[model samples]
Target: MPDLAAVADLEARLGRPLTPDEQARAGALLADASALVRDFTRQEITPVTGDTLVLRPVGVLLRLPQRPVTAVTSVSAVGPTGSVLGALSGWSWDGRDKVDLSCVSPAGSWPLSWTGPLPDTYQVIYDHGRATVPPGIVAVVCAMVLRTLLSPSMTAGMVAERIGAYNYQLQQGTGAAGASVVMTSADEKALARYGPRRFGTIALEAG
Candidate 1:
């Protein structure tokens, strides 16, 4: 799941079979690019079911976690004494922090010591994560992988060198133009165009 781009896709972009080392390194770098995608979106790719998400009540409103939430199984309030109020009834999930209640429950009105930084007033069990990734995002990831495979000297510049992040630069070129200094490789230019440049505001907030 860490690999954001398929090996076949990278091979297609590379236009050749990867060596054993290149395959391994590409896998690792793909993982890094994936992590960047996750971070850029501020969303988790793999969210487990039956996990609880805590929402701090801000007046009558509460903020939910990253969206496309599948279900809300239960709700509770944290008491001032740190004990949890039992599950409540008559609450409907309306999406994106919009919840309808037949009546106010004990937990909903529960106040923390300081409202500036609030303790979670509400807790719920919900399943949530991105349902789809944009094709352009996937293309960017594949481009990054292709760039890494095309440049061995630039391995140190890949995100996987630090457990999942982009180094923000293309690999140096090795193709010589006679005795003149070699220019950037076409592969590197493609990567620079498709890599981080793809993470626009829309892509950043993409689910």
Candidate 2:
């Protein structure tokens, strides 16, 4: 995956051109920043087509791990022995990543009732993700990289020492190498919508 932000984006934020050293380091900073954001959000946040997701369905309500699912091409059930049992029907995309097995199938029957097994695995082939990266996500990535790029070498904490009126001070908001790359609480809030679903997995249905 490419870095979410670019050198141009960093230059734009800084309102000045990067020196040669800064330019050389920007790539690494951007890559680290993008990885951190993706890690925090647990999303690709990029468009993909014909993506496949496999699930050992825990319940009638199946949630796809990706976002903005545009289409479902097929669903198959595989037995515990690893043979694909057959094609599954009646599952419908719920506009996002969820699939409802309880829906009426084209054959006019609920699809949740499997003929032969406990712990059947489902393979879903689908199209999902955004056509373009969201602006907010890009902004967040830029901010994180910029912070690291511009930050002085120091950690964000308190330091105090008093010896015969000697005084020395190191400012806050600075940290060890790579410390600025962490996703802060604000970043989490900004990315909550893009993060993984919070719903608890229900026990598998065996009807």
Candidate 3:
């Protein structure tokens, strides 16, 4: 579903080749991992282009709705009834975390004097995000899925002995996991290595 990682990428992380069956299962796992990463970071992994906006807040940063924003088509504000308020001239996009709204045009700006928050007031039509998924994120996904695939029993909670005794314990086994939802320390390590997108007062471009 999400093309964050390739089958070859998954195979590389697995340190082996994937069977025909594994390939099908790997697709599901990769899709799950992609969604988890986006939710975890509160960042959009998919690329999208449309009109979006942000309201004025205490901080100078106005985080775009969808990010990392690839391009800003236009920046403007609208009233509750969708009336044109004003446009920011000296504003900037960090390309990741936020758009620097340093310049506020017109004193009677919406929310500055009216209701509704900034994230709702302003309108920015732009192409947001990238198609090239981060390698770190890909690695993280593969590692997580690999763990599940390598431990189907552990993930399935099938630790019971084959006998009626019902005794169970974790043991090594093999199978491609349908999905990997379990977060492990390794996942955190991978994310830390990649690091989160930093946000700050950025210039008009190159952020």
Candidate 4:
């Protein structure tokens, strides 16, 4: 879940309490966020190997095979530095499924796992000297998710929070570098918290 203090900070930065009209817009954006998360979980994460990649509503769980020096490429979205995409032995999910990708690495690999989902629409491409999966696909998935979750009335603050949540999840999972996935369980919780507020606010404040 997003930090309440952080939310307040966001509002402060925006220099205003959400207007009634802004609240209405925020609510709509929240609804879009909920829907986008749902679609991404259903369409992209679930069909993949749950053993290697656990897809929950909140974020994803990835298990590294061994400790090795691996280079994560095509992570333009994360920045040019290419964050730490080392060998993860395992990771812990809040309430999502557990996936083991221990078989995917070579010997002497530094094993480590990330525990979160994507933030906004970002990607982390892993280059293992072989054709694996492109990180851009994850970015694409994130873009779709964001698009699905956005609305015209969404407040800048609310949208920022949603985007922050998304980034927080992804950052938690892959650290600075790794493949991205979604945590369906946590995401559901997020949906519950943000969804109703988003939709209900529209009705309550609109009138």
Best candidate (score: lDDT):
2
**C-alpha positional error of residue 14 in candidate 4 after TM-score superposition, expressed in Å:** 1.8
- List model 4 lDDT by residue over 174-196, tens digit each: 22111122234444553342221
Best by TM-score: 2
Candidate 4 or 1, higher TM-score: 1
On residues 11-90, what C-alpha lDDT tens digit does candidate 3 reach at each position? 78668899887776777777777777776765666676664544443376655545566787666665667666666566
Report lDDT (Cα) of residue 80, candidate 3. Answer: 61
RMSDs, each prediction? 10.8, 6.3, 7.0, 21.4
Which lDDT value does model 3 have at 63? 57
- Candidate number with the higher lDDT (2 or 3): 2
- Decoy 2 TM-score against native: 0.73
Error of 3 at 141 (Å): 0.5
How do the predictions measure up, each by TM-score?
Answer: 0.59, 0.73, 0.63, 0.20
- The whole-model lDDT of each prediction reads 0.53, 0.67, 0.60, 0.29
Clashes in model 2: which pairs?
154-174, 154-175, 155-175
- Name the runs in model 2 displaced over 4 angstroms: 103-115, 154-171, 174-180, 201-207
